[model samples]
Target: MTDTTSTETAVRTGLFIGGEPRQTDETLTIVDPAKPGVIVGEAASASKQDVADAIAAADAAFPAWSALSATERATLMAEAIAGIADERDTDAAVLSQENGKIRFEGFIDALVFEIRWNLALMLADEVDTGKTLPVVPGIPVTTEVSYQPLGVVTVIVPFNWPIAILAAALPHALLAGNTAIVKPPPSAPLATTRIVQRVAEKLPPGVLNVVTGRDENMAELIQSPDVAKVCFTGSVNGGKRIMEMAAKTLTRVTLELGGNDAAVFLEDAVIDDVHLDRLFAAIYDSTGQICMNAKRVYVHRSRMDELVAGLEARLNRVVLGYGLDEGTTMGPLHQPAQKAFVEDIIQEAKDAGADVREYGTLPGGDLAGGNFLRPALVVDPDPSLRVVTQEQFGPVIPILPFDTEEEAVAAANDTWSGLCGSVWTADVEAAQRVGSQLVCGYVWVNDHGATRLDLRAPFGGMKQSGIGREQGIEGIRAFQDTRSIATIDPEALAAMAH
Candidate 1:
């Protein structure tokens, strides 16, 4: 993709408040993960006062924005979606520059498509509405339930796939008659802030807000009493802290937390070199930064060697470097710190007696400068090891041997987080049965992360993964209030009043 913005043009990089773009004295430098030394872009660092201003905007605009009919809200959402699409190349370029993802892989191709996929979820469903009310027992009276807006919502998104997740939560909140304050990840705020600025013109003032910063400034925004609800996506520790802060204001929250998802390979599963390669491609894509990335692989002891050998051979062909390079299957870790953390864990796994081997050579002579780590596969990993159990958000996979389907399901569910997992087997009944046994919000059979769910599927978790849903008709209900209105005939009312 090309940079659509003219060379002479200066990008309006700042905080978005009240449907306007304004800069702050404080600025945050966004790094290019591909070349750690290069400064790709900068975003305004919102102060406490800026956050207060955003909440104030949300508060002032909520009444009008919410007063519009669902059709009107949906129209504005559709316009914003179109505007975002118009800025696709620009957004993609900026995303690649700031995120250190390859322009095609990271920006236009991989994530923008996900954003559009999420956009399809924004179109409200008329069928799900107008549900009939249940009749009262021992009486001819009836009670109906309707959805109402929850007021101003604050969306705090994580770094990886910021645009997609924001699209996931924001449209649902707005369509339900609520305004939004979007807090982009501090590390890569430029793309999101700019996208919001470009699209804000399509909505009424205060309908949506974007604030960027590095510290607790946004935390105060999430905890503000003026903010009605908070939707967050990040690590478990970060989520816990946000929940605690939200509790002070009794703020409603939807926490999409971390995941330690796994993939199970049964002995009966059809095995071929081509199939194994395709599976590795899905897992290692995006350097395994995806929340649902296969962090752990449980293989039957009988086929463990075959799977390991196939994975190692396929991984050897992956081209690892900056995302912009052609055929670069593996990009650098999102940050230098992330690279260090992944390396530490890999060494830890090796120290734990697991045999570790690298597939591709590190990129360039200056591998130390960039945040790249060669994709690695650890064989015969102990189930209790940190690499096997924890959410290692990197291009590392740990292989563990399992004896039976029960053991595989048990191993998959033995985690603090339950976001998503996958089960592979030849028997249709076995796949469905074992898939149900794994404790997760979403599961894939014979697949890794592809889902065909519409806006009507509830997207959330049961354990530490998250608190509330964020897709489909169920998601819109999350941003709404259910009130019971009771009525009776005049004579009955008189008798009840008496």
Candidate 2:
């Protein structure tokens, strides 16, 4: 990992509306999550009028944008993406400072956005591909089935993985011929706003826009009559709120919400070095903030000790420090409230007599006041404990032991969350059998987590986890509406009349 400490600098960002930068008198000061007192940058605080202007701009651009062929739009998007990598170094440093992930993760966040953009572009030709239903031997009607753009769309991304998460829907919406207005989370808006503005600058005016501000000023983004669809990636409660707001206009919505993802290890699972490393990264990568990060681990009783030992061996080497520091293996929570929340959960488990072992040394000096917490593994806590049941969204995780494959699958599916789950085992048939039973949107066999996620596959949740899928062909179609054109064949019509 490259050291970005020396390059750290404050960023000032403005809203992108009608493809131009618009300044606001009021600004929201964004603080460094690693050092709360440190000001990372200021973002333009969009007002209700600004939000309206953004929606209006997107609505105005929808006609021409939607009229163009998917191939034409893709060519323009490719040109825009070509220059995105040029400023990645600076953007990565900015993201690390504000969001508190290590610089390498920040770099990867931007890179993933570009990767997803190209992937979405690959489906341009198929976006408009329609099927013709020929008149049957005795039928009189011929029909053409096609997909059409759904005007303006609003895309809201969460703070955890702003740029990468935005890519899950933004590019697809544009390629589907819907103009979009992106709303980056207020707490960590600088880097996202900067990157989105850069891309928006290269595209036609009003084709893409960005708004950053307090939640109080964002209702119009979702409820406005002009917004045909709203795609949001955030908490379950937030998704519900978005649904309520969009209900006013009966606008369409696609929500990718929170999760309490589980990882199950069968009795025959391999507990070797490679598998152990994969498990560790799957659980702790991004400090366990990822929605798909394994929150609870269920290991068959036979492998419990080995799995715990392997995790501890890796946890013992964790280094908590500033995200820009090259030596830091993990950074602080994105906010103080989250740090306190995780700490309270760990304390509650310890108070209940669970064997909770926390590892890592907090960096002193400048980082003394940072929202830092050592990574912890709670060994076989009561299944109902918050550490096991809730989405920790931090560096602490619960590992429980099960007696059989049936018990493991049951334990994994017990939660209300159905975002994702994984089954690990050497027996291919067992992996299949257990993985098929896990009640989640996507299942991983032998491998797990975001690092192992297959981007080409449809990803989402079930029950309260989410409303619709993002990515793949399914994701592209989320921004479109279907149309059926029917014509009566003269000969068939005459035959029917006779």
What's the TM-score of every candidate structure?
Answer: 0.92, 0.98
lDDT of each: 0.76, 0.91
Distance from true location, Cα of 90 in model 2, Å: 0.9
> Which ranges in model 2 have alpha carbons more than 4 Å from their true place?
1-8
lDDT of 1: 0.76
Tell me the tens digit of each residue's lDDT in model 1 across 1-498: 124332122343788899887788988877677775666666788888998999999999999988887877777677666645666667766776666666664454335434643453455664125544544434444556666788899988888778877766777888888999989889887777777666676789888888888777777677788889999988889889988999999999899888888888888976686568657855786678777677888989999988888887788788877565567777788888888988998999888878988778778764457888888988887777778878888888888898987888888888998988888888999898888888989887776742223334677776999898877666777888877665544554455556
Q: Estimate the TM-score for candidate 2.
A: 0.98
Q: Ten residues in a row with the worst lDDT in model 2?
A: 1-10
- Which one is best on TM-score? 2
